[model samples]
Target: MALNRQLWIAIASVMVIAFVSSLAISFQSARAYFEEQLHLKNIDNANTLALTLSQVEKDPVLIELMIAAQFDTGHYQRLELLDPSGEPIASRTRATDAVGDVPGWFAELAELRVDPGIAQVPDGWQQYGTLYVESLSGFALEALWDTTVELFLWFFGIAAVLGLLGSMVLKSLTRPLDDVVDQAESIGNQRFIATPEPRTLEFRRVVRSMNILSARVRDMLGEERSRLEEMRQRLQRDALTGVGNRGRFDDVLGALLADDDPNRQHGLFLVRLVDLAEINRQLGHQKTDALIKELATRLGTVAGEHRDSFSDDHLARLNGSDFALILTDLLDAKPLAERLTEAMQELAARHAEATSLQLALSAGRFGPGDERSSILIRLDDALARAEHRETTCLEWATQGEDVDRLHGSDEWRAILHDAIEQQRIHAAHFATRRIDGRLIHREAMLRLEDARQTLTAGQFLPWARRLGLLPQLDLAVAESELERLARTPDPDGEPIALNLSIDTLLDESTRGRLLGLLASHTARAAMVSIELAERAAIDHPAAFREFCAVAVPLGYRVGIEKAGLAVTEIDVLHELGLSYLKLDRSLTTDLAASESNRSYLRGITGMAHAIGLTVIADGVRSAEELTQLGELGVDGASGPGVPE
Candidate 1:
């Protein structure tokens, strides 16, 4: 039982016991008082009657008439005149029937007994007769019952009023305990919250201890998070130039290309420092490093000027004497390339005045769906052409003459619509396993099929998203996966995870359709897990939360994929009630060699685990990386190194 109920029961028991005891004592006292008063009244009446009869003339009829008058007027049970030898000469009797509204049980329990009064009457020198008088107890019994009922009413009313007041007081006094419980629950969810200390000394002490503990935990997590962020920056940045390193640049490029949005254009510029060896031989390594840093700074400035045009632009130092600039959505890349070339030339001119050094800049532009290797190969070819033509000659790759069957947005939309309508989407399964080789789940990657080719999500998803057809496509993928899961039973009974697009979650009709489909397949629903990108969840938290509210109760697990990219919003992890988080490949790349990345991963994994979320490392390319991830407390891993 709750404490409140227990308290009320205790209080009520005490009140009832006291009331019953008091009523018993009071009823006995009132009954005794009535009996004593009746006895005294009978004695007094007998004495007065004896005195009056002694003074009266001796007549039988007169005596009988006097006895009858007394019996009629005084409400007596019996009245009689007796001789000196104890023989009754005249007597009157009345029935005892007037006990008003008192129950028989109560009258029996509180019955009052009274003795009749006796007196001697003398006529001149001799006793005439002995007189006897007695009063009925029915009236006294009725009065006692009334008094008992009145006493009970007062006691019951007082007890009820006191009980209500006591309940209110108890609830107020224990209200702090509710706050304590809520705070404890929040802490369990990895949300460090504190409650105000109660005025009661013992409760106050307990609350104070809990608050202190919460604050200490919050401080520890905050410090660890700060250190991890610093380490992450060190791992991603080039040490000398403070720009992105080669690995960071590659991760960004892969993400951009994988998006596959045709309208999103990007330009890649490769700047090579010519005659770096000559400069080093003459001026030393320190001067060459300083020159490279200065060039990196200049590239950052040029990129910053066009930041609005290319929101996802970045600069990186690829290697010695080689730096690259990547800009997005630059429809006219020639002007930006020309401007960057001029900036490098200006730097080269200033450096030449002091030493014999030159800068050769080559620029190349690649559009959506272009392979990363092909872009690099084409940029290398352009750089070679520039180097052969002259020093510091800028070149741009010409658009290809080869045409795709789906040429425009309308054509691509039609193909995607038809594919979704016909359920042409298929899934590729990848296994995520624990360190001990136990399979956690299989992740599903969506694939689209057509007459010409089988396309990956990267090939067709961007077009679907651009055309507002992502919800339809995602629903189709889910339905197809559900059907497949129903048909193919896994020996291990591992669940299949499907990735959800932001559009699918935000669209009400799509969410409804997906939910209906899942609801129909109750057995298969339990075998399905949905993964949402962390960025998308953060962007539309209300919609994601609403989706989770429905999904979680229906036996569907929800996870956030590519989680580490949005570490700043890590608090949302608890709010979303996620089952797992997939660390982005960028953070997990080269984990075996990078101490900074390891420390960062440890902090992330710890924080996620504290919130009851399993952390899985993505793109684990080697056993060493997997081992390091295990040491850092990662729950599972999936990539080329792990078996499918």
Candidate 2:
């Protein structure tokens, strides 16, 4: 065991010994403290009573009966009357059930002793009798019992607190060992990572060793990674262009084509320089390489714009003035090619004027039904056909399909409007999450249905915005949803959350109507939460703040959605006094071994908690992500992991 545990055991044993010893001393002292007072009180009362009894002319039997009656009612230990001869005539002992019912073993253990009161009697200035009295020990027994129980209870409670503190110390000391192991494993597995050291001396030594080991292991892995990266560059990288070579591009294209879905076609754009040999003849090899490098730089800039559009797809330079891109999840093929050509032309125009060589891009697409080997043949043929073409960009068939998909945007607006008017709104999909088993968060989903078309937000919202009707369309969706909700399965006693857009906020009439309708359902509105995206939040901060100020007092709770994006303005969210905050999806999706995202989430989540705002992480799609969020102490979460 570590020193903390050893210290705990030693201190506990000493405390146990000290507690027992102190208890013994306290018991005896308590008896002495109360007994002294009890005995003194008895003496005073007996003396006063005897003086009073001396002037009385009652009969002897009556006097004895009166003294006995007082003892019966009072807390007297004993009462005795002696004749003028100094012989005991009448006697009575205290008979309270308090002392009588207690076990003798307990009374003896405390060394309880209650002194009896004694008094003198006088008849016409001569001694008549002596009175002996005993007060009840029950009060003293009760006091002693109370003191004993209280003292022991104090010792036990303090000892329990000490035990808890000792355990915490042990945990803190051993805590760094866990971090050390984690760092070691990360280093050994070729993950370059480090952890903070433990505070304890003994564990710090072990942690220092692990730190050194972790550093050495990381250094070794870094050296190895550098070596492999160089090898990869040498084998499949172009020396002058500094981009992936033809072999690498070939491999990437093969994999992308193989993975294409039947409904989604993948596009390949091959850009071939028309005059590489001509440029080399006029300019030396060095200047030709310089031009190619400039071309490569421009291509990279164009590629950066589409980086976040998809995953596992990349753009690379194949060879002299030749580049390729693998576009997946493409709904259609034609417009993507035209867009690529327009983007490249825009980027190309930025280069110095009077450049002899221009960029030529020829695109050939392969669908799930196309054979991989034949796709390359078609691409090569397209490149060959573009050799003498006048235009810099050309597409090989399927051009009209891209034009049709481009036109689909206008159709989406009509589709959304018809879905709302024709009562085609599908059943709402809402997800629920519990926090501390006390509060539940309901996340609402918008479902669209048509004979042959159903739309995801990603596909339809852009069209709504483009048509300048998103405000009207959003209200329609909201009204349809609420109208359907009002019909059956009301959201009473449940906190239901919905979203509002910037366009809606700009519309005074729609905003008033939306809030008015929601306010009518006061009970549900009290449990209702309205949310807006961070981009929209920042864009219309003034309007949103005003809206929230009015809505919140009307029994509505407001939340800033995609909160992780505005981590810098966490105080802005706090100032608005939000009831809940939903973290950005991208932040949660990037939580695997990413130091930046984890730190960002931690800081923002801490800020949210400090402001008394409920923190809900959205798009927690994995068990590992859920566990990580729980460890970070997120208030609640709703995603695929949460059941509907």
Candidate 3:
């Protein structure tokens, strides 16, 4: 039984027992008083009758008439007169019909007994006869019944009022207890949350202890995240300028090009400092190194300022004099080229030693199916062309050969809107599996079929976000998956995971529609899980929390995808109530090769498991990597390398 119910039962039982005991004691006391009063009235009436008879004539007929009159006038059960020889002279008895409105059971329960009063009537110093009178108990019984009824009514009413008040008070007292239980459940689920202290001393102490635990876990997670971040920087970043190195750039660009989605396109820029050896000798090593660092910082600032232009961007130092910038889904390269040229000029002007410095800037576009070597060769050719034009020039390698698929924002918006309206959106399922080769779930990646070709989310998602059409596209995918789940007759069919953009989750109307759609198909809702990028939770913490608060309780699992990209604030998972984390491909690639990567994975898995979160690694390209991930405590793996 629930503790609250038990407490209520205990309180009710006590009230009932008190009421019964009080009623019994009160009734018994009232009954006894009524009996004693009856006895006293009988004695008084008998004595008065004897005195009246003694004062009157001692005729038998007269005595009999007096007895009848007294019995009729007073409430007497019986009246009698006896001669000196012990024989009855006159007698009067009351009938049983005189009992009033009192119930029989009550009359019996309150039945009163009193001895008949007896007195001698003397005539001239000689004993005459004895007069006997008994008082009727009907009147006393009726009064006792009335008093008992009144007492019962008063006690019943008071008890009802007290019972209601007690329940409310109990609820108030136990509310804090309920909050504590919820906190414990959250901890068990790997989400650490703190609750306010209750007014009750015991509950307050318990809540304080739990808050301490949550805070400690949060601190530990923060430290772990920092360590992972440090490891990632060491493994992927340029040691001198604090940007991505040649290897990291190759890994990222290779992954992009390797994707099957033809829509994966980006604008790439390669900046080379001309006559670097001469400049280095003139400026000395320290000043030249500072100048290189300043250049990297400037590129980082530009990327930050124009972050919205690209969904994903990379800035890297290929060598001492060569730097690269790749921006995904950039429709216009001329404006960014102009911005880069201005930044380069500012760098040269700021550093007086580089007044005679020359820079060659080259720009090109690459997409899926393009070889990494061919793209780099084209950019190199463009850099050589820029050198011939002047000391510094911006040269486009693909000139008129590669035009953007869409001309302007309006065209992009129209195409995306029509794609959604025409039902051109669909899903492609990729299975995620456990270490034992059991199916976990299939992730449904959204695909859009246009007039010319098919586009993956990676190819078109940034444009959709720019056009404010993500909510519509996300809903389309969600609705399709829900329909598919509903069509599957098996209740235990494999679950499917669908991604929702942060913008969709933030839109109030879209969120309502999504929740309503899921609710309308409650049975299938559980067979579908919703996912968002880890950056979503870190950027819009309140919105993510609100969505999870509603979605998780409605039988839909909520998780973070691409989790390890933002390792510094990943500890926010403790407060976001996420069910799982999907490690990004960069972290999982060549998992068995790098000791640093293995250590980072171990730390991530350990922290995630301690908090009760399932960890899944993405882009596991080989069985060896899968095995290594399993050994590192990853719960699941998904990629082309994983078998169906």
Candidate 4:
């Protein structure tokens, strides 16, 4: 039963018990009082009669007549005259017929007591005869009936009233608890904090304790989450830009696109800087890094708008002059691209003075049916098609028969996952950036060639990440690149910069594997510096540093690609003892035009060189910018600008 019902029941039971007790006591008292009154009346009448009989002495007939008259007028039994020896001398019957309205059973049940009465004979002790009488008890029985009925009515009426009042009292006490429970459930991933101002002192105290406990739990959970998130962010983010890394993009984006909900669409874009080499030469690495940070903050604001529509759309630095975005679960591509271009236009307007702030955004859209390789090829194509010094541009990819298609939604992901584990991944083409005749770093793009045309890294990246298969992909692709390097030795003794993910590095096992892969060639160790997106390193600064502590000593150096304009705190990257920094594409596309861009590139390069780090420029498509990079004293330059 409900608490209120149970309380009311208990109260009613007690009241019933009390009423029963009261009724028993009441019944007895009423009987005694009525009987005493009747007995006193009988005694008074008997005394009066005795006096009358004494005055009528010497006349037996008058005495008998007076006694009979009194007996007939009053409620009494018989009046009799007996001798001193207890024998009856004279008697008046008074009962004409000896019939009674009361049944024998009822009279026996009642069994009321009557008081004895006596009349003096021969006028005060003559001793001729003694008078006898009985008292009436009819009034006593009537009184008892009336009192019992009143008691019954009162007992029922009072119990009902008390029962209702008691239930209300209990309800008031428990209502606050019900409210507390509701508030607790509403909390989600968030924590609860409720301090009620109850009217009752006891409840108010309870609420206070509850509030304190809730706050404590919230704090504890938040602290734990912060610790775990720091580690995860380190693994999945870029160190310089403070955004997600390339691993998160490939793995996370692929999974998002695979979900073929008509409500959600997918878009990925790349933004490159035009003047990072100039910035590195003029402003130094510190200020160039600052510009990347400023640009990241601006773009992040636009991406944050779709936060609710997407679960985890990560934006990250892919390399210096190249920042990437994996927009998961979008409604459509056209509007998203349009909105992005608008956002970039606004960003450019804000940093109009920053020459290195010139951003060229190349966006690509793909659906569930679209092939991963084709999408990436299309993005590469879009970049190739991007106008010189363009601020914003967009393109949508279509599905073709040559691209891998699965039977069901999950079947395709399964195939890709199997391919990565078996080391089926192969490299198709490599673009290397050199300082003069020395080959320093090479950007290795993967190709899945299986009984068909070559597949680009983009095709598998999205799926691999989505299916939680990037670790496998990272291993396969890195190992393949290393194997190819072992076969094709570079004539130039320059350091080789190969693409590496902070995700794989943070994983001790993967880091160990990478170390083992590079262990054979001690001469190539300094030549092969692993490249990563800065967002990953920054997010996991501590862990990345820890991994570096182990790996850097093993003769493996780290390089950061997709380095943005600047970030909240870029000191973490410098402190980690990184070897090289690449400017993100967003800041470099129009380096020659924007003065702000010149300032930023100068700032980042100067900072990097101050820390004994080399700055490599990627996506340098024009010869004019190439000559400008040489003037800026950039350590190296990549993209189509290197006399392709």
Candidate 5:
């Protein structure tokens, strides 16, 4: 029961008991007073009648006439005159009837019985006759009943007013408790929240303790996340230069290529220090390290500028005396190549007096259909050509080679809009299976069908995002998948994971549309899981948390895809209430080798499992890799090797 209700019940019970006791006492007191008054009247009337009879005459007829006259004038039940021998001389009596408007039960409860009055009649010192008179108690019973009714009405009215007032007071007093309950529920949902302290001392103390506990937990999570990020940086970054290490570079390069966004064009620059070994032989490792660090800084500066123009760009030191910088959305590599050439000349001039340290710069641009190995090979060939030509030379290969043949963003936007309106999007399923060969779930990949070609998400998502058409595309894809599920529910009852773009997930309008679509098809919600990229989740933690807060309760599972790349901050995962974490393919490739990778995966899996999240490895290529990942505690794997 609610606190307010319990309080009201108690208050009402007390009021009823008090009202009943008061009514009983008042009724009894009134009845006693009325009986005393009647008794006095009876005695006084009888004495007066007897005296009148004695003064009038000793004759029985005269006495009887006077008594009868008095009896008629007053309200009396019975009046009698008796001779000295105790024989009745004359008597008058009348039957009593209950008054109207009073219940029989109430009259009986309030009835008053009084004794009749007796007096002797005197005539010259001799007893004339004995007179007996009794007053009627029907009127007294009626008065008692009326007073009792009035008392009951007054008590009931006052008690009702008090009950309402008490209820209001209880509601106010317990309002803080409601807030505390909501706070507790939010915490259970992995959302740490605090409530204002109540006015009551005990309640305020409880609230304060909860707030303190919440803060402590948040602080602890923050510390753990910081530690994890530090570890990630140590594992992925070069010790001499603060740029990404070879492994990190390979992961980023693979991800960019695997993304296969047709509209995306990435520029790669490979810089080789021609005289690094000679410089180190002459000036020692210290000066060589200084030179490498300076070059890394310059490359980082260029990457930063490129990132400002295009959000996805990276600089990494692939190996000793060699560094690579990748730029996204740069269709032309000539401009960036020229900039690097100028920066290299300046760097060489700075080291002119110390040593003849020249730099060889080679640049290549890769796009949707380009393979990572081919791009690297072409970049290496360009570097060789630069080194052979001249000192401090820069060369560009495959320039203006991978430009898009389709229409501009506006036309593509129009086409995408038309496709969405016509519901031309379809979903492709890729299976992920557990170690025991049992099916876990199929990941639903979106495809946009045009008159000419059916484009995969990687081929069209970049353009869709650039054109601000992701929300529409996402809605269309979700609607299609839901319709499919409605027709044929998953045979294994496993949900199909659907990817959601960061913009679509965060946009309020898009979120509403998605929710409405899901609400209408609630039965399919349980068979649907929403997947957000790890980068997006890290970029927009608050938005992701809010999205999950709304989605999870509606029976939609939330998971993170491409985890471990941009997920240095693991604390957000705890707050996100993720159902699973999909290890990016870069993290899982060749898992049997590389102790460093194995250690990182172990740490990630442990952390995820601690928070009740299953870890699934993506892009598992071989049986060996799958077995290794399973041994490492990965719950599931999905890739070419895994059966569909």
Candidate 6:
């Protein structure tokens, strides 16, 4: 059925046909030549014997003796003598009709027939009697059979050698076709990668055409990502400093506070340049802007050093003189605030335009159940007190609860370890649906419960990550999801999408274990989807690629959550056989107001759908946003706004 095999069969058939035809022609020619030679020998020998008899005396008894002597001396089947009147005769005949050493089948096929040689003899004065002489043909037939067999063997050997040579040549010629087939299959899988062109003229043309198509798609993705990034910067970024604006900061903080987990808390630093007006008056606005940009960059770098995952939105310029730094993890704020002060002083010393810079830093913690207005007022009050000190300084805002009461690192680690080992880890399912209200899947978020309280992933994931137990937690979540699927085996049941941490995917041993579990429950695994954060997937592409390569084949739909955050990695998306891409909640917030973001999202959905990936929006808070998402060709959306 394969093309290569078909070609081999055709070549073999041609060789067989040629061998048969050549053998038949050669056998026929050998048989004719042997028959002619035998005929001539029989004629010559018969005439010679009859002439000898004519030279001798004619006698019945003597003639009989002559015939018997001739038959005994020569290779003959029969010899005869007869009178001219055909009344009396003397004859010599071979008693046994056996073909010596030749096979019966070959003898039947040869079937040699040569006319007997005949001659006349006369008496002394008159014709005493007419004599008849004939010669045998068994030896002649045996010679012809040997020649035919030798010719057949020669033809067979030549055909076998030609067939071997033809097979090798056919393989070489069709090697390029194999590559073409592989390339087509990759395209079918939606991984648009180009392959090298082959030397065969026809195959080279086809491959080059496919490569062009792949390149076009890649270029389109790159162009769309560039456009989306440009629009996002315009909407969410500060023009002068390139960090997030006040609006972007509010969005991130609001989302963080809106989480259902009361234990979710992070440190926030509000830094104000106390002398921005004075600096702009004394130095040019350009110098002031440069100074602000420099300070923002240094602040972002410090935040990056403290946190493993860094983003531009983490450091934002709230206004002309105020900048905010959000650290997602709870740490000793004084030490980090000291580092910021040192960085600011270093910047002041290096700036040639400014004589000196004064700043007031307000540090505090913010979480759920806290009012944004009240927290800002407290931090502003703290900033006023720091400004009253008359020197560059930092002050901590008053908190309703003591930070020291929180669990220590070892305690949290033990708690997480016990929860996983004791099988206390579970998941809460959130349904995502299509525009037509059909259920797509139920997204699973990890939850940990104890005797008195329940903890969401937003509450405990940071600690789990800090304690390096995310791999265990992720495995626990996958196991829970698998068991849930096994229990609910209805064909119409919505699949559960399990979120896998980048930590587990990056570790070889953990990744192997996860894949092994999926392999064991292959049928049930089909009812579960695996997903990773967009930023993590972008940061570590090799691990994401390897994860997809393994998980996708195990009947798991692999995808990226919080997608559209990193637009620059769009080119890598087509290379990864992803099942879906979930747009971040930030992209959909107030979608009706921002035409730029709508266009950006439209481009994302277009490109994603072009490659056969389903696009979903996360945290849609209003019917208006959901309707707009549907109008933009988004496949599905999930949030408080989407009705169950």
Q: Which candidate number has the best TM-score? A: 3
Runs in model 1 deviating more than 4 A are 48-105, 120-132, 197-203, 240-243, 247-316, 320-379, 386-407, 415-456, 468-531, 536-559, 565-579, 586-600, 619-632, 638-644
lDDT score, candidate 3, position 574 = 71
TM-score, cand. 1? 0.69
lDDT digits (tens) for residues 1-644 of candidate 4: 77777887887788779887997887667666766776776667667776666676557677667767777787776678777788876676544322245454544555567676766666555666777777656556655656666787888888888878776776787777776665454333132556565777877777667677666755654444344345444655678887766654554445444432322346677776666797567667887788788777766776766543332356777777777777654433455566777877776676566553556667765555566777777776666555363545543433331233323338647667657766667755445565573566556666665445545554445455445555666778777766666676564533345666545766778777766776665555655667776766656676667766655666777777877543324444434546777766544655665454455566566556645678777767667876777666677777766653
**Model 4 misplaced regions, further than 4 Å:** 1-37, 57-65, 82-111, 123-128, 148-193, 197-209, 256-265, 297-314, 327-358, 369-371, 385-644
Q: Which candidate wins on lDDT?
A: 3
Backbone clashes, each candidate: 0, 5, 1, 91, 0, 3
Write candidate 6's Cα lDDT for 166-244 as tens digits.
Answer: 7788778877777777777777777778888888888799989989987887687777777767877787789999888
User: Model 2, stretches more than 4 Å misplaced?
Assistant: 1-16, 23-103, 110-200, 206-228, 302-321, 329-355, 358-360, 371-382, 389-407, 412-644
Candidate 6 displacement at residue 28 in angstroms: 2.3
Task: Name the 10 consecutive residues with the lowest summed lDDT in model 6.
Answer: 304-313
Better of 1 and 6 by TM-score: 6
lDDT of each: 0.77, 0.65, 0.81, 0.62, 0.78, 0.76
| lDDT, candidate 3, 163-186, per-residue tens | 678778888998988898898888
Q: Measured by TM-score, how close is model 6 to the native structure?
A: 0.81
User: Model 5: runs farther than 4 Å from truth?
Assistant: 48-96, 120-132, 146-176, 193-201, 251-269, 277-315, 325-375, 391-411, 430-442, 478-496, 505-528, 540-558, 570-573, 576-580, 609-614, 620-644
Model 1: lDDT to the true structure: 0.77
What's the lDDT of the predicted structure labeled candidate 6? 0.76
lDDT of 1 by residue, 301-361 (tens): 8886654344346688888888888875453465677788888778878887668656666
* Residue 571 in model 3: lDDT: 48
C-alpha TM-score for every candidate: 0.69, 0.46, 0.85, 0.50, 0.78, 0.81
Descending-lDDT candidate ranking? 3, 5, 1, 6, 2, 4
